[model samples]
Target: INTGAIKSEAASSMEMTELQNTESGEIISGNLHILANSTIDNKGLVNVNQLFIDAETLNNQPDARIYADNATLNTSTLNNNAILAARNNVSISTETLFNNKNAEIVSQGNLQIAGVSIGGALTSAHQVINSGGRIEASGDIAINTDELQNLNAGITTQWVTDSIERIIEVQPEGWAHKYDVSRFPLIHNHNVEGQPFTDENGNIIRYFEDYTYYDYTAKTQSTHIISSAPAKIIAAGNIELKGNVLNSDSQIVAGQKLNISGGSLQNSATPGQKRVSYNGTRQFRDWDGNDEELDFGGIAPYSPAPKNTEFNLGVSLFEDSHADIKSLANIQTMTLPVVNSAMFSLVAKPTKFYIETDPQFLDYRDWLSSDYMLQKLAFDPANTMKRLGDGY
Candidate 1:
């Protein structure tokens, strides 16, 4: 427009005689086109919130340019032949440019601009030349279908089958062997140092090359000593000893049963310093009656009598049979009247004698008679004469 000022309030179209620089400004509805070269000066803002430009009839020239600031361009159709051109510096912000169809450009010079927004897809069949400026969009930027297929065909091919066969050839053939202790000596015989030798199928094979003699004597002795050792005495049993029971510092008597009838047993003491004395009577009365018979079944009475003598006596019973009193006759003739009264009057005498006053006599009779000696003597006293040493 060759006017200094032109403004339109509503839908109106105007035709200009010659497009020229306006000092004030120019505004038009529907569309605005400048057929000649024009400059938009500083402090001159051109805002088109919804505007469309048609370059189909312009022959796509390189000399054409459109300068707008804080303006928007909304195009409805974007065909392959449609074009957009911007002159010098075009700073667009707070604006949007949408294209419904494709766009193309044929330019040689650089498009020097800043902050331009595109709101739709941009497709280009030919090359896009951006020498210095930046073009940004929120949507996809793609090439045309024919150009896309040509780009994909330029990629090189790979031989996947050959790569897979090479991988298979280099892979290991067997599984790993694990270490264990239960298969020790046998396992060590087959090993090459410490690692196990494996077959092709990953199974361990006995190679028998690394055999070294193992001193089993020391190992077996150590195990036997450990298993045979006794536990420490946390609490003493009923049995107590008057002196140190251990023979020496190196050995221990583990299997013996100690009987503490009257004294305390000392684990570490001098010969008689740590003596254990009788705390109570060795021969306890079965009941209050002193005439109570001693049961010789479990223990022999600690009384001065024959080995097989059973007495109707109590806690006043005699000491155990000593070597001096060797027989029943020796016991009967002793100075102790209690011994003769208890032995001769109360208990019957043994008809057969194995040995005189021998502790082995009871054991011998028990073994020979097979547990019937006590029963036979108690029930039938006359049976003693027939059996003799061999009880019936």
Candidate 2:
């Protein structure tokens, strides 16, 4: 029961039934193979410089546990339901550390804790890698880099949701500021309809006010047509859209060459009004007529855009075709002619398209005239009604 000196030279080949009351300080330098049921309990410590377990003799009945300051287990095969729990440091390396289809090793420290599991727990702090294995742990799973030469090694981890909650913090300071009104002082006190007027603190002050004007006789004239001559229109931050912009066939396309280098370009469709319909039972269906159905019932069903009803058209010039856009639906066709020394032209025919230009070209006015020309041709009464009636 109380062995002062315990040594197993060929312990890797032998089997251990039960190892108890080794509190006298037992030292195991060789492999400690547990072929049958074994338990090292009563707070007894089995100090092993190195340990090994045979893979062939592992079974459900034989479960091994070691309480030691530091222990190393190297094995090619492990039986099922083998629990190797260490109080301090535990190191294990095997072709596969598996037992009863589930093997677990746990190591807990003050600064960090590590574990590994093929079917169960195999814990270590220095290094842990699971190639084609699964690991379920409550603590962190990190690589052992002290002895490793390469820094970019692959590591897989499956941590509990509770652990992620503890590690990741959601601070108020991390919240992004949506709009900053101080930059645009003209927009501060302006009572523009539907334009968001915010104070210096980025808080919205006045929203869209729906008030119709009876005698709102404004200038109703077409945009100035400047032949084929180029013009320029620039903005500091962004170009936003509030209402639907449609062509003759109700299709929307890019008006001009838009460039925004610093700020983000976004497009958001206004949701339609919801209409409720009652089924036979108490269940009621709220249909906004905005849900888009995709036909993929043969293999699998996947609809990326479910609440999109309207289509969009985007037209970019040869110079501004590569701008970043938010969304693009079905593109029809594009025509491209070689310019300068650039190889192959880029063309896209999109049903619904959104383009984001660079901000650096905002103040640059070379593309503005082209934009105005396109807009004038797009909205002219003579051309507008014909284009709309033609069913683009």
| Predicted candidate 1 versus true structure: per-residue lDDT over 93-157, tens digit per residue | 21112211122221112211111234643322222122111122211111121110100101111
Q: Evaluate model 1: give its lDDT.
A: 0.23
Supply the TM-score for candidate 1.
0.18
Best by TM-score: 2
Residue 75 alpha-carbon offset, candidate 1, angstroms: 7.8
* Runs in model 1 lying further than 4 Å from the true structure: 1-52, 57-67, 70-135, 138-193, 206-392
Model 1 Cα shift for residue 381 (angstroms):
99
TM-score of each: 0.18, 0.21
Give Cα-based local distance difference scores for all models: 0.23, 0.29
RMSD of each: 55.7, 32.8
Best by lDDT: 2
What tens digits encode model 2's per-residue C-alpha lDDT throughout 1-392? 44565666654544455434333544444446433344333223343434433332222222233433344444433332333443345444433323222233433321122223356654332322221112222222222211111111121222111111111111112233323324332223433444554544567854322111111111112111111111111112222221121111111122333232322323322222222221111111122223322222133222122122322322211122344555443432334323211111222323211232211112122434333554676654333222211110
